[model samples]
Structure formats: C-alpha cells, structure tokens
Target: MIRPQWEWALDDVEGRRLSTPVTPVFTAQYDAEQWLGEHWRELAAAGAAQASLLHDGKQAAPGVELRFP
Candidate 1:
C-alpha cells in the first residue's frame, strides 16, 4: 500500500510526536496547507496539541514541519 499525498496527524497536548492519524481530507498540498491555516484553532481547541499536514506522510525538512496549535 502507499500513503496519500496529504494526511492529518494529531499529537498530544505539547507532544512532539504524532499520536494518531485520520483519513486524509485533501488531495493537494496547497489545499492541505490552506485547510490547516484555516482550521488549526478548532483542531487545537478540540484537543490537538499540534496538528500536521503530512506531505506523502513525511516531513520536508528537519524542524520544518507544518504544526499548528
């Protein structure tokens, strides 16, 4: 099996690692990034310490992960 281009990951409040993964809601990187910027607060308030929009289930660079509170 292969990973999707865009996927959502959730970490515990103040955690550094992703604790869970849900179905990807976006197919494009741009859309995924936009979605995170738009709905980050809601996700955080709902119990996400840090939310990430994974690109092909990987990070582009070290310390360059797209994480939001």
Candidate 2:
C-alpha cells in the first residue's frame, strides 16, 4: 500500500507561520523540492521567505528542510 505521503508548506520569514496558501501534500521529496525550486521566487515575492517540506512533524527534504531569515 502507498504511504500517507508527504506535505509541503511555505512560511513567512518574519511571521514564521504556514503561508495563507493551501499547502500541498507531496508524495515524494523530489517533487516538493522541484516545486520549491521553481516557485520559491514567487512565494518570496508574496511575503514568504521560506519553504518547508514536512511530514510526521519533521523535515522530509534532505539538505534543505526549512529556509528562513
């Protein structure tokens, strides 16, 4: 059976809370990172200075988990 999968969230640098967006649940880390790599600039423009790939209350993406100021 497939696992519950993973999830990704964007956070405001100064706010440090989940972005107002409906964070998506990712099935794999690669997909999450790929999205962040592409959309991070947009998020940053919208007041989100950090993107997080999380699951089970911990970081799901290796090397880069949370990006904050």
Candidate 3:
C-alpha cells in the first residue's frame, strides 16, 4: 500500500515558492499539522507569507496566512 505523503508548500509575499528552510515530509496529516503549529512563527519570520497543506503534491486544505502581529 502507498502511504499518503504530507508536506507544506510555503510561499513568499509575492506568492512565489520558497526553496530555503526546507519543509518536512510526513506520513500522516496530523503530524504535518503539528509541525506547522510549532514552527509557524519561525516560518513567518523567514518570509513565508502563506502556507498550504499538501498531500501527494495536491492541496489538501485551505491555505494558512502566516502574518503574525
């Protein structure tokens, strides 16, 4: 059986994909979400303007805004 691939697609203010600060790939969606919850602040500070949850190279949910006050 093929396990689902979970990852985050991070974008910049201009909506361009980022190459640095590589995102982690997961076997479960829950683990991917938890990783985001813990590192969102750093991601935002790293110039990530938005984040989208992806499963097997396809969008799995609505994108998240990374702007923090």
Best by TM-score: 3
lDDT of each: 0.60, 0.63, 0.94
Specify the highest-lDDT model's number. Answer: 3
TM-score list, all predictions:
0.59, 0.66, 0.93
Better of 2 and 3 by lDDT: 3
- lDDT per residue for candidate 1 within 8-61, as digits (tens), equals 677755665654434346677778777767776666666666665577767532
Tens-digit per-residue lDDT, 1-69, candidate 3: 999999999999999999866899999999999999999999999999999999999999999999887
User: How far in Å is the alpha carbon of 10 misplaced in model 3?
Assistant: 0.3
Superposition error at 61 for model 2 (Å): 4.7
Model 1's TM-score against the true structure: 0.59
Error of 2 at 40 (Å): 0.8
Scored by Cα lDDT, where does model 2 land? 0.63
**Residue pair clashes in candidate 2:** none
Q: In candidate 1, which residue pairs get closer than 3 Å at backbone N, Cα or C atoms, i.e. clash?
A: none
Q: Which residue ranges in model 1 land beyond 4 Å of their true spot?
A: 1-4, 14-23, 61-69
Model 2 TM-score on a 0 to 1 scale: 0.66
